[model samples]
Target: MIGQVKKMIKQCFFSQNNIKYVDYKDLDLIKKFLNPHARIMSRKKTAVGARSQRQLAEAIKRARFMGLLPYLSR
Candidate 1:
């Protein structure tokens, strides 16, 4: 479940954008952009940190999208 949510968030925000900065207000839009699974994960993970999640999510998304992980080739 968590993995699916992470994937959805990646597909929505990371896949589409090349920018680093995201507005707090824009979080709603980004939330809508994520898949249902990701929505759940986002909600659950919200308590982890306010701004850090966005940054971490963005980084993970970017990394996955770029095919930078060696194991991803498999």
Candidate 2:
């Protein structure tokens, strides 16, 4: 294993998809960042950048406020 070179892969979804804006109405995308408990996942867990993570959090909060997404899991 001494000669093995670890490959670092970027797993940022927004970067891969070229999404500049995070939309609260996009349940599919927003749901990906939420855990079963309806909490926002951490940046390390989601592999999202700092800025994108903030945007995601804001969108999720907005969604919850608008009753589009649940505040807590059932």
Candidate 3:
């Protein structure tokens, strides 16, 4: 274990809440992944896995299409 650096793992929101699906209608949850400028956060920033990040992006897009979320924020 010499010179082996330990990486800290951050827990994902879905896993913590025991959520199975990413829902577009859940504005609160979706907002958490979006930045103040209304853009989706990166995986590194959100600390979410690849699959969850994809799902989150899809949900955000769907929400915006349905007029639930804003495309841009002031």
Candidate 4:
């Protein structure tokens, strides 16, 4: 017989600290929400609320425009 295990999603960054803003300058933090391919993680995957997800998307775009984050991997 075999048993199945379930993994729980972690709390969102903003939610955990009650952060109201997602800054583009925080590359280290933002990058965590992006996959190795450079695509944004979905709300379901990040376990973030709708509002925070939108904020995160906007921040990522800003960072990309400023050349802080790569749009895609080579």
User: Best-fitting candidate, measured by TM-score?
Assistant: 2
Instruction: Assess every candidate by TM-score.
Output: 0.31, 0.89, 0.83, 0.82
lDDT of 3 by residue, 1-74 (tens): 86798888788877787777899999998999998899999988878877888888999999999999999999
lDDT per residue for candidate 2 within 1-74, as digits (tens), equals: 96798888868989888999999999999999999999999888879988898899999999999999999995
Error of 1 at 30 (Å): 19
Report the number of clashing residue pairs per model: 1, 0, 0, 0
Off by over 4 Å in 4: 1-10
Task: Give the lowest summed-lDDT range of ten residues in model 2.
Answer: 2-11
TM-score of candidate 4 relative to the true fold? 0.82
Q: What is the C-alpha lDDT of each candidate?
A: 0.45, 0.92, 0.90, 0.89
C-alpha displacement of 9 in model 4, angstroms?
6.2
Candidate 3 colliding pairs: none
lDDT of 3: 0.90
- Candidate 1 regions with alpha-carbon error over 4 angstroms: 1-40, 43-46, 68-74
Q: Can you give the lDDT of residue 10 in candidate 3?
A: 87
Q: 65, model 4: CA deviation in Å? A: 0.5
Cα error of candidate 4 at position 52, Å: 0.8
| Candidate 1 lDDT by residue in tens digits, 26-71 | 5454454345544224635433343545665564465445543221
Point out the higher-scoring one by TM-score: 2 or 3: 2
Which candidate would rank higher by lDDT, 1 or 3?
A: 3
